[model samples]
Target: MAQVLKRFFDLIVSSGAILLLCLPLFLIALAVRLESSGPALYWSKRVGRRGRIFLMPKFRSMRTDTPVVATHLLEDPDRYLTRLGRQLRRSSLDELPQLYSVLVGDMSLVGPRPALFNQRDLIELRRENGVDQLRPGITGWAQINGRDELPIGEKVAFDVEYLRRRSFTFDLKILFLTAWRVITAHGVSH
Candidate 1:
């Protein structure tokens, strides 16, 4: 019953958001392309619910030659960032494309952020903690809590907590906090 309601909410909210943000999305994509050599969107293989692999798109924020790994893993990650990358990432404008993932039902508007397919440690922890049962999200409890600043174990802990306490109200709280966090660029290390 709750899952049904949540899905309905996700659909309605995501649809409206997409419709309202279409022009901004297109302009952001154009800016990404104008600043970088690669395509405007970077499609990443992310681990979704039940360990499924899905392509999650983001505005391309890094150089064409950047390694296909978590940004934290890169040696001197800043060097690989495109000219506009830092601002895009800090403002989280790069993540705007993921609204499509929510619209298509590949993700929720709130839950655990999807892990990169190669993040075996995080994936394993999530699976062991039953976090994999929940759909991946565009923004999540962990995202609002600490985002890039949290260690993997701590992030997974927050994910598990969210799994245990998930509800429409909780989702709304997370969404509110995420907006605040993005506005302040809090907990964003890069």
Candidate 2:
């Protein structure tokens, strides 16, 4: 019953957000293209619910030659960032394309963030902790707690906590905190 309600809420909210932000989304895509050589959107392969693989779209924030691994793994992440990438990442405008992932069944508005497909350690930890049962999210408890700065183990701990405590009210709280974090660029290391 709760899952049904959550899905309904996700659908309604994502739909409305897309409708309202369409123009901004378009303009951001244009800016990304104008600033870089690659496509405006980058399709990242991510591990979704139950270890499924899905293509998650993000605004292209890095150069075409950037490695496909998580940004933290890069030797010098800053060097790969496009001119507007740092600002986009800090402002989280690069994640705006993920609203479409939410509109589809591939993601939730709130839950554990999807892991990169090559993130074997994180994926294994999430599966072992039963976090894989929940849909991956656009913004999550871990994201609000410590966006890119958290260690993998700590992120899994937060994911497990979210799995245990998930509810509509809790989801709303995570969303609120995410907005605040984005506004302040808190916990964003890169």
Candidate 3:
């Protein structure tokens, strides 16, 4: 019942956000293109529900030559950052394009965030805990608790908890917390 409600809410809210934020999205895309000599959007292979692969889009925050890997795993990831990349990341502007993912059912408004396709350990742990059955989210329990800073094990633990405790209220709280965290740029490293 809650899953159905959550999906419905995700569709409605994501649609509204897309309609309202179209101008901002266009402006951000222009900014990204003007700052770097590459496409404004970066399409990444992300692990989705049940370990499926999906292309997730974000503003091109890193240089064109950046290796396809987790930002945390990069050798001096900051060295690959494009102009205004840090500000985009801190303000969460780079993630605005993912609204299309949520609208298309590739993601939810709240759940465990999708892992990079190469994040085998996290994928296996999530599969073991039945978290893979749920749709990934733009912001989630793990995200609000500790986004880039959480260890894989601890992040999976939070994801498992979310799997068990998920509800409309819980998702609403996560969304609220995500907004606050983004505003404060809390727990975002690199």
Candidate 4:
């Protein structure tokens, strides 16, 4: 029942957000293309529900030629981050494009964030804990709790907890907290 309502809300809200952000999205796309010699959007394989592979879209925040690795593990990630990338990432604007993922049913407005393709250990742990049953989200409990600063194990724990206690009200609370975190520029360890 709540899942149905949540999905409906996600559809409505994400659609409206996409409309409102269209201009900014266009400007960001232009900036990304101008700043680097690659596509404006970066698509990467992510682990989704039932161990499926899905292409997750984000605004290009790093050099197009860089090796694929966990964001935190990047060698001098700041070096590869483009000029606009810094602001987009810090302001959480880089994730606005992911609303399309929600509209397409590949993601949710609230859930555990999608894990990278190479995060084998985290994937295995999530599968063991049945966390893989939930769809990936744009912002979530783990995101608001510690974001990139949290270890994989802790992230899984928060994810599992969210799975167990998910509710529309809970999701709204998470969303609100995420906004606060972004506004205050906290937990943006990336």
Candidate 5:
């Protein structure tokens, strides 16, 4: 019953957000293309619900030649950021494209952010805690808590806590907090 409600909410909210964001999305895409040589969207293989891999679209904020690796793992990742990439990443405007994923049922508005395909440790921990059972989200408990600053172990701890306390109210709180965090650019490492 709760799952039904969650799914309905995800569908409606994501659909509305995508519709409203269409123009901003187009403008962001144009900016990215104008600053970089690659396609505007970066379709990354991300671990999704049930540990399935899906291509998640994010605005391309890095150079086309940047290696496919976690931003944290990159040695001097900033060197690969495109002209407007730093601003996009700082404001998390780069994530607006994932509204499409949420509308398509590949993500939720609130849950663990999907792990990159190569993040074995994060994937293993999520699987162990049954976090893989939930759909990945554009924003999540971990995201609101520490975002790029948290260590893997700490992130997994937050994810497990979210699993234990998962509720409509809690999801709403996280989403609201995420807005504040994004606005302040809190806990964003790069």
Candidate 6:
């Protein structure tokens, strides 16, 4: 019953957001193409539920040739990030495209963020902890709490907590917290 309600809410909200953001997405795509030479959307393989592989779409924010590694692992991740990329990432606009994923049922508006295919350790931990059982999300408890700054262990812990306690009200609170976090520029590291 709750899952039905959550899915219904996901459909309406993600659909509405995608429609509203289409223009901004176009302009951002144009800017990225004008500033750099790569696809406007960057698609990388990500680990989804039950070890399923999916192509996660994000606004192209870094040099196309950047090695597939965690941003934190980069010597100077900022250097590879394009000029517009920084603002998009800082404002969380880079993640807007994932709304499409939600609409398509590959993701939810709130769940555990997907792990990169190359993130063996993170993936392993998530699998061990059953975090991979849930659909990946655009914004999540981990996202609102610590975002990129959180270690994989801490992130999985938060994700586990979310899985256990999630409810319609909890999701609403997380969404509200996400809005506040974005506005205040909290916990965004990169």
Evaluated with lDDT, which candidate comes out highest?
2
Candidate 4 lDDT tens digits, 150-190: 99999999999999999988999999999999999898865
Instruction: Please list the C-alpha lDDT of all candidates, in the order they appear.
Output: 0.92, 0.93, 0.92, 0.91, 0.91, 0.89
Residue 69, candidate 4: Cα error in Å is 1.0
Off by over 4 Å in 4: none
The sequence of per-residue lDDT tens digits that candidate 6 reaches over residues 43-154 is 8788887889988899999999888987889998988999888988888888888888888888888999898998999899988988888888888999988898898899
Candidate 4 vs candidate 5: the lDDT winner is 4
- Give TM per candidate: 0.97, 0.98, 0.98, 0.97, 0.98, 0.96
- Model 5 stretches astray by more than 4 angstroms: none
Clashing pairs in 3: none
Spell out the clash pairs found in candidate 5: none
After best superposition, candidate 4 residue 116: deviation in angstroms? 0.7
- In model 2, the Cα lDDT at residue 190 comes to 77
Q: Which portions of model 1 miss their true places by more than 4 Å?
A: none
Better of 2 and 4 by lDDT: 2
lDDT of 3 by residue, 1-190 (tens): 8778888999999999999999999998899889889999999999999888999999999999999999999989999997688889989989988999999989998989999999999999999999999999999999989898899999999999999999899999999999999989898887
Off by over 4 Å in 2: none
Root-mean-square deviation per candidate: 0.9, 0.7, 0.8, 0.9, 0.8, 1.0
Candidate 6's TM-score: 0.96
Over 119-185, each residue of candidate 1 has an lDDT whose tens digit, in order, gives 9999999999999999999999998888887899999999999998999899999999999988998
Clashing pairs in 6: none
With a 3 Å backbone cut-off (N, CA, C), the pairs that clash in candidate 1 are none
